[model samples]
Target: MQHAKLKRSLTVFPIVLFGLAYMAPTTVFSTYGVVAQITKGMVPAAYIIALMGMLFTAYSYGQMVKAYPVAGSAYTYTQKAFNSHIGFVVGWVILLDYLFLPMINGLLVSIYLNAYFPSVPFSIWLFAFLALITIVNVIGVKIAANVNVLLIACQFLIIIIFAFLSIKGLLHGMGSGTLFMSSPFVNGDIPISLVLAGSSILCLSFLGFDSVTTFSEETINPKKNIPKAIFLVALIGGGLFVLISYLSHLVYPNFQSFKDPDSAALEIAVYIGGNLFQSVFLAGYITGGLASGLASHASVSRLLYAMGRDGVLPKNIFGYIHPKFRTPTYNIILVSIFTLSALFVDLVTASSFINFGALVAFTFVNLSVISHYFIREKQRDGINTIKYLVLPLIGAGFTIWLWTNLDSKALFLGLGWLAIGMIMLLSITKMFRKQPPELSIDHAEVNEMQA
Candidate 1:
């Protein structure tokens, strides 16, 4: 009997919306103070830099997804572009994020909830939120997408209100007393190095765009929609990040004045409106958490399903999709189980691993585009040179620069985690004597696809 395949129920819009939710649009507020401080109130400029970097890499992801429209994402692309062993390693490396990102989401939301309902145990908040996320994912992708759309809408609503109030406050002489200010995007006094530093930090905000590629199997016309969705998600997410930070800089020109850089958004909320707005802001934050958790939970589960279906991981548990629900049930549960680690793990430690795997995946995906198209196919004629080689080269350069700029703590921990993945890869391939199992696509779908 053939294995139950992932159902195709998505299009460009839903996946694009899901990617926005995964990026957690409201998160710009949370980190506003820190970024402003880093860039000397040039958060908008930093976001622009970050957006450019993501766009270059986003172009590469778009290209590769067109060639190989499968759920494996970076791992599949690298493997096919190169070899199974390298692909196995990339997939294993990506597991750092795919496995724990859901945990981070659950933990953060639980932290916020625990603060509101201090009487309730942190574990209780974690479990309740995780349960909701798990149940939604287990049900189906369409249902999960619908839930995220609601949550994403709520976040955007909060952001819109905050922006309107900030503008109102500016008109009434609350901040710089003027609307247009170039200082946020460029300051003669602030060094470019600091702006670049801030951009590196903001790049994390662009993380979820690539996660969209994991849904290729579920997307209608994977070749068309998947590539379109990847670029759109990155552009929308980056644009939102830039706009929010710019407006915020105008409203609160003094980045150094906040007592707590961490909760700076709360101060901005209360300043623009009042305690009422702050309360509304907190409620909206819950929606951000919900959106991020639901999206990440769904994405990681799909990655696991892809690897499991390929027999690189245990096929029975990770590969099996439900016949009725058409979801990867066991992998969903496993991701939820991994989320339990949130209770004990701190944010810093968990985040370190994610950046490493995320960067490696980004770097290799760019290389995969070049490896598959430029070198492998020798598509150097005319437009193919720019399409195959130049764009991905720029993309790879940006990711490599971003990799170099990783915080020492992140670099240390990321390299350590990568070492572990290498060891695992060696054992899986028996010391390079054999190839890792190749990813098997649903050929029925591939045959239907046009060349």
Candidate 2:
């Protein structure tokens, strides 16, 4: 089932768009609202700082991807940097995170659906959204990418429209302020603790960029294009988010009133454009969320195919690729089934089930970056070492700090989910009588690489 490389159909631009599309507008805009509250109005500044932090880690990822472009992104990087065991753990944690991301997006879409049609049950909305996308994912990757390209274009247009409207509103005194309300960079009694807290939350909106590497096998020019797409996606996505966060402050200066994390941006849209534009805004947001769900579905399915091909998972079940399409049809369907089931769980649990896995994944990702550098210092010397080692250490430390600050229920639930994933891993290993091997790609010893 394994191949030498991804098909040459997918270009860098489309894949980068996929990453950006994964961070849905509602997710991005609402995240800005939450960060606005936490930072006490230093919303954009916080994003800028976080962008700097993310850039350091991104550089390391860029190098890693360039050296070894493979489907199991973090798994390959961690294994190459550290060892197979740690790499397997990284792959496991990332898979756990990716599997639930679709459900999170679906549940979130349902929340927005409620605002539009109060009579519709959120559970129904969740299931319908999950099912539709799951089917699309199972159909094939090219079809899935085509869908994503359209969705990304739509979402990008919406954001552009939003920026135009918000800027016009600010210029015409329709908004609360022009420049930031306070000395945003200087002193506003902004707590360091709060910024740290908000940055962690903001990290969620930026999580999907790394998932691009899951397409390594499908990308046209894997080595050059993969790294290019990742850096550009992160750069563009992170930059736009910062701009939107700044724009959000102009539209909704009173961030204190936005205690409700979920609907914060919707409230801003309502306030900024009134009822007429709110409808349009919400429509765009829903589209963005759906796009995000679809992207998550596609990426995770590829990860499953990669794992299965390596004999770590149920090879027969997951390794079945469609000969005509060259797509992992069975893996996609299996992931869809799980995600669809998760839709129900998310609706009932209110989606706390999603964030915990993501946090755990982020924690390990940061740790992987740090450990990879320390282990490969001689090979990865100079600024690259500091960029890899130091930045990831900060990211990891900050993530842990935020993890501690999460609500008690979240903490408990996250731990419980981790335990469950561990159990699942144990069961799978025992069933197969073989553990997932560590991922490694020595640049010096490399021939052609495949996902």
Best by lDDT: 1
Clashes of each: 0, 2
Q: Give the TM-scores of the predictions, in the order they appear.
A: 0.80, 0.75
RMSD of 1: 5.3
Least lDDT summed over 10 consecutive residues: which range in candidate 1? 442-451
Instruction: Summarize candidate 1's per-residue lDDT along 1-451 as a digit string, tens digits.
Output: 9999889999898888778876778878645677788778999998898788789888888898888777656777888899888887777777777677788777767765665566999899899998898888888644444665687788889999998998899899988989888888878999988887677667767777877877888888998888888899999988988888888888888889987664678778888999899889888897777766776787777766777776667889988998988888898898899899988875544554576677788889889988999998999999999999998888888777766766667678678877886786787779989886654332222222101
lDDT of 2 by residue, 243-359 (tens): 887787777677788645456777777777777777887887887777667766776776666666766667787767888767678876777677666444523132334444555
Candidate 2 segments exceeding 4 Å error: 1-26, 34-42, 69-72, 134-145, 183-187, 212-229, 256-261, 298-377, 380-388, 391-404, 421-451
